[model samples]
Target: MKQPPAVKRLFGLYFHHFPFVMLTTTEAVFLHTSILIFAMFIAYGIYSYLPATIMFSISRASYYLFGESNTLGANTLQY
Candidate 1:
């Protein structure tokens, strides 16, 4: 019996990184699942933290550029 294209692709992606070795279907599935879970955790961490990091950087930059006081008059044009 032939494997489906998706299964073949998954094996190709996960197997190529290791030395040529035999793996039972269960072991392969477990390895793939572990890798996927790890990837999701990393992605979630970035998603949760990136926005706050960007906002902090922006505010810090603005404070340095605009100085401690808002001395500009209402007529002053901000670039």
Candidate 2:
């Protein structure tokens, strides 16, 4: 009668985008779908990674700034 939480969440996410999804059927549609899913995964990964990365960077920088050294903005990408 009831679905599990993970299943519900999964379906919820799928249905949430269902209305906007353009259903397609053409030559090599499976290949195109695979590529699109791969791109979506990459985008989602980067989207999820960004906040944690910035938080860790800021935390490490602040630690170095206050506790370990007086140097701030020492690391830079030289191009």
The candidate 2 region of ten consecutive residues with least summed lDDT is 68-77
Per-residue lDDT over 1-79 for candidate 1, one digit per residue giving the tens place of the 0 to 100 score? 9999999999898678764367777887787789899999999999999998997777677768986444324357679
Best by lDDT: 1
Candidate 2 has a TM-score of: 0.49
Give the runs in model 1 whose Cα sits over 4 Å from its true position: 1-14, 19-21, 69-79
Report the Cα RMSD per candidate: 8.1, 7.5
* TM-score to true structure, per model: 0.65, 0.49
lDDT of 2 by residue, 1-79 (tens): 9999999999889657554355555634775688799999999999999998998788787886787443444575557
Candidate-wise lDDT, in order: 0.78, 0.75
